[model samples]
Target: MDGQREREGRAPRRWRHGPPRWNRWGDEEPRPRWPWPSTVLVTAFVLFGSNLAAHAQETERAGLDPFARALLFMTGAALLWRQRYPVPVVFGTALTTLVYLGAGYPYGPVFVAVAVACFSAVVAGHRGAAWAATGTLWAGHALVAHWLYRWLPPPGGPAASWGQELVIATWAVAIVALSELARARRERWARERAERADAARRRADEERLRIARELHDVLAHSVSVINVQAGVGLALLDTDPEQARAALSTIKDQSKEALGEVRQVLDTLRTPGDAPRAPAPGLDRLPELVEQAASAGLTVEVEGKPPHLSPGTGLAAFRIVQEALTNVVRHSGSRHARVRLGRDGDTPRLRVDDDGPATGAEAGGGGNGLAGMRERAAALGGTIEAGPRPDGGFRVLAALPLDAKPATHVKEDDR
Candidate 1:
């Protein structure tokens, strides 16, 4: 039973701890502790106040006796389990109240016990049980007052007035109405809490994806350059010492730049709400990419000036170009690549192409680099087209709009 309860996300009921307790409104909580202070105070009120009522109605109803006192105590004590066992408490209180009235005890704070029980039951989602318990008490009172009064205690007492019954009915309606209002408000609060939790989860997921893309773009480009330079340095070490030294120098510079960018990304994770240490890389840094590619033994030609772009669009454009060059170095035999930048009215157009018979090992376009490029474009309501050109090379074309709005849904390749 304990194992089954654990699997079902519930704690097994333990007899040693008595019955499981709950909040006043019976809302489920992770941990439960008994609520006894309020119950004790209420019981005290019922006991002391009933003696006062008996004194006031001494001539009309029987005085407080052992049996009458026991019945009043029973009604009040039942409320100790009102939150945990609302239905049973409500019915128990009503039954004891009925017995007290039948035995000719004067009306007093004994009714307070029934009211508290009914309120607990109604708010605990047991409306029918609460209503039935209350109705049974009221109906039983009418029977004893009007028809059974002759056989009951304090003989020859007149029947209860219709006005008194009307007042009792109105009080019952008011209790149920107030309980219903409280129940509705609690439900609304629970819904708002759930919505806030869901929104937080979504924001966390988006931030995680953004960080993954940034790390991939940075590491892929820098590592590709370093790998190429390492190979060139090893091959030229004996044939040309100066060329090998230049290759080593390029390796050091690329590695240093890569580490700086990675540390910046880590700093964001450590202090997420703080401003970034440096501005994000954008198209304005295109010359740096050109120089890096040249050092990696790949020639890159810039055809046209990139148009002015928003910070977000510029960053995406720069990454798309960086990832494109990285793929060329890692997957192509082409030594030269061309980049064309233009604007079709309000939309910025970027194209990177390289003459290539793609390396047979990784000719397929199913890598993290391609996926990251597509994700960047889609986030800004843009589109990416990356594939082999008809005549020879591989091509990556992006159309990014100036009025950037994230798409609700973005369609991409299976990759």
Candidate 2:
């Protein structure tokens, strides 16, 4: 019901298309449109004493008082605000009916007031009041309505209608059951919508993280290489124009490659299915990295070959080695480095060591370089430990799952 939307704070008045449709008898209807029951139900009740007089001349039914009819009509009119004041309406109608019955009014369809009131209570989320109304209606039907008819003798001395009493009681309790079922259905629907909203948020976070990793990997590698080539070009520019020209050419190549990788990452976001993926960089490129370091003034040694891994894992391994070498060139003031590849216990491990002092950059605690590496390793269910070695240098060791399903956005404490 749209009223439930209002209760949930959505301000459902905006969705109201027209005046309350009388046929809003179903759960799918927005406002729980109840039949007014104003003119018809009370008028029917008021005519009961006259009808009984016509049927049995000797029967002494209570003559209808103007005040009793006044109260009855008032009870029906008050039901118009049931949606806004459900509990109050139910209690108000029930109290007014009690007064009317006590004032010696003939029994008619007055029980319809309680039935409609109880149904309204349940729809408006007043379960406690609905149950209270159910008990009140049952008691009034069993005691008051029964005695009102059997007060004086009729011609045949017939008892009050037991079958009619049962029918009225059954209708009151049936309305309570119907209201409970509607409440349960609306609760279940609300829960499903919440779950869908949470899932959408998780997907958005994952996409943002993947793009961040791509940018960090591509930009860090290219910028480090360009830094070295620019330094080489400046050093050789005075007397050796030939080598300076070569270094400039290498810088141009690095810029083109970085720009191309950046473009591919952006395209993947815009046209994911249609964009052609470049071969993911992996440990196979380590030799080229070593040669590039050799061009710079650094000595490097490789220990073993890379193991087979998934694409995400392979890219993580490549970036770890790339970041390690970049730190060696930029922070470790040493010329010699060692890279070892092997299995550590049950997982694939990568170890990059260098005979250099533990500078702030190489110590692996501050800035995006170390945080990005940790993020990558943890994304594929892995860990990285980097610190100064006891032998007076920095050592970075990372271990990863042999085969891991790519996970969503990762956190440092994910493991």
Best by TM-score: 1
Each candidate's TM vs. the true structure? 0.85, 0.68
Q: Could you give candidate 1's per-residue lDDT for residues 149-242 as a string of tens digits? A: 9999888899999899888888878887887788778767876776787788888888888888899889888988888888899999999999
lDDT for model 2, on a 0 to 1 scale? 0.72
TM-score of the candidate numbered 1?
0.85
**Candidate 2 clashing pairs?**
none
Q: Residue 306 of model 2: what lDDT? A: 91
lDDT, candidate 2, 1-415, per-residue tens: 8889888988756545555533222224356555456535544654564346434532434555577667777677667777767898898888887766555555555666666777778866789998997778567656754665355323223444788668767776787898888877866776576678678877778778767877876777677777777888999999798998988887888788789989877777876466446777789888977876665566889998798887778888988888787777767778789999999766889999998874444222333666678878887878888877898878889998977755443444210
lDDT of 1: 0.86
Off by over 4 Å in 1: 1-28, 360-366, 409-415
Which 10 successive residues of model 2 have the least lDDT summed? 20-29
